[model samples]
Target: MLTRTFLHFPQVGERRERALWRFGFCDWHAIVRSVAPSPWRHLWDEWQREAEASLEAYEVGNAAYFAMRLPKSAWWRAIPDFVHRAVFLDVETDGTHRITVLGIADSEGYRAFVRGQDNFDEARERLESAKMLVTYGGSHFDLPVLRANFPDWQLPPLHLDLCPLLRRLGLRGGLKAVERQVGLSRSPQTDGLNGWDAVHLWWRYVDGGDERALQTLLCYNREDVMPLPTLLALAYERLWAQTLKASQQTFLPMMGSKERRTG
Candidate 1:
């Protein structure tokens, strides 16, 4: 028996069109002109208007609605706080470079879904809902696959490339390497399969319909989501503790001089 993932369809509304537009499924100008005759045309017009406003805001180097927009004084503090709710994302693709599945995890739990599953849709929806997204090496690879696969789906969320952040904190290497460096252990079930193998396994399952292959693929995907929280926690510890210590050291010199003057 195949284990299928489930997804719920959000109620049909204006946001769906906005999602489509955001991901570039259709041009706002073209859509607005084409839909002008329909009664629901107003909905499309409103969506396009809002999209234009959003683009205008971004053009001026402001991302006010995005999670990265924080007051300068609060920006550093916000990174750690926001990461707590972030969904760490990863993807597996076929040898031909087509994405076969996606994995995401947060405080709630981890989820992995094949391309056509309702669970895939649910995962996409959750991604759309997040205030921040955390991923290692997702900026160039994982994200492009997602946008390509779900052209009508809005982007997952405001992305935080944990790869750079991890580097900044002196942790070196890929996701698995970082896991090992930070002392996060993996379960025995995930022993043999790495991400590339996981993608091939999915292709085997999809093309050959081998149940054992599918099981292996799912297990690998589950493993991918499992370590993300630990990695995120480690990042938080390193950034927050280091930043706080630096702040104190910066202030310490002023304190000594003030004490000498008072004495």
Candidate 2:
């Protein structure tokens, strides 16, 4: 199941010094000089002071952050609990420049609606109500597209990002490659199309009114949603196993110190 954890990174502000130590230059100063070609030295002090204050607030627990955690054992259970509240989202855009359509699928079913379609409002309402959002590369693309298209819409927190997680674990390639590595199979209808193709296909139908084109686009969209549950299960399994291993290693060090002291 999709689970979320809020974490406070109190020391993230200290990263500025670390960055300067490693790079031999302050990030803001370097960026400003490179972009403007004019002296931005006066702005540096004010910027650094503001950044330090922001970091202090974060350390003091004034900043909030969230991450999705999925446990491996949860996947093998009779029921996948995470899917109950998770929404699998895929958007079909006219081009990389703009979002044209948003296709959302959940346990209930699927819906494909254009950004300005009559039913787009209803679909957006449903998205806002979901408990968790599951996607492959949403943090970089899908989430931004959704935010841009529906400026007022607020999505549930992301529960899992299969693509980056897989990459982090040294799994290579894109979603399809990960599927193969994990032994997840797909139908021919879906096998032939990738997300970019799906976006193009949907744009064709939405802009041209070709029923056949729409059918293929819907099939592709449905395919995108179908694999999400499996991907989520895999990610949960891997992350949970790693977490357990790390906990054991940490405990061992503490236990060893205690035993030495007692001896």
Best model per lDDT: 1
C-alpha lDDT score of every prediction, in listed order? 0.57, 0.55
Q: Tens digits of per-residue lDDT for model 1 on 1-263? A: 00000000122233453344333334323443454445445555555554454344434423234333332222223344345456778888885557776778876778777766645668877786665676787878788887777788766335766677788888888777877888776677676567777766877888888878877777777776677666666665566566436433222121112221100
Of candidate 1, the 10-residue stretch with the lowest lDDT total is 1-10
Report the CA-based lDDT of candidate 1 relative to the real structure. 0.57
Q: Model 2 has how many clashing residue pairs?
A: 3
Q: What's the lDDT for residue 127 in model 1? A: 80
Off by over 4 Å in 2: 1-83, 115-118, 203-208, 249-263
Tell me, by TM-score, which candidate is best. Answer: 1
Assess the local accuracy of residue 260 in candidate 1 as a C-alpha lDDT between 0 and 100. Answer: 18
Runs in model 1 deviating more than 4 A are 1-76, 249-263
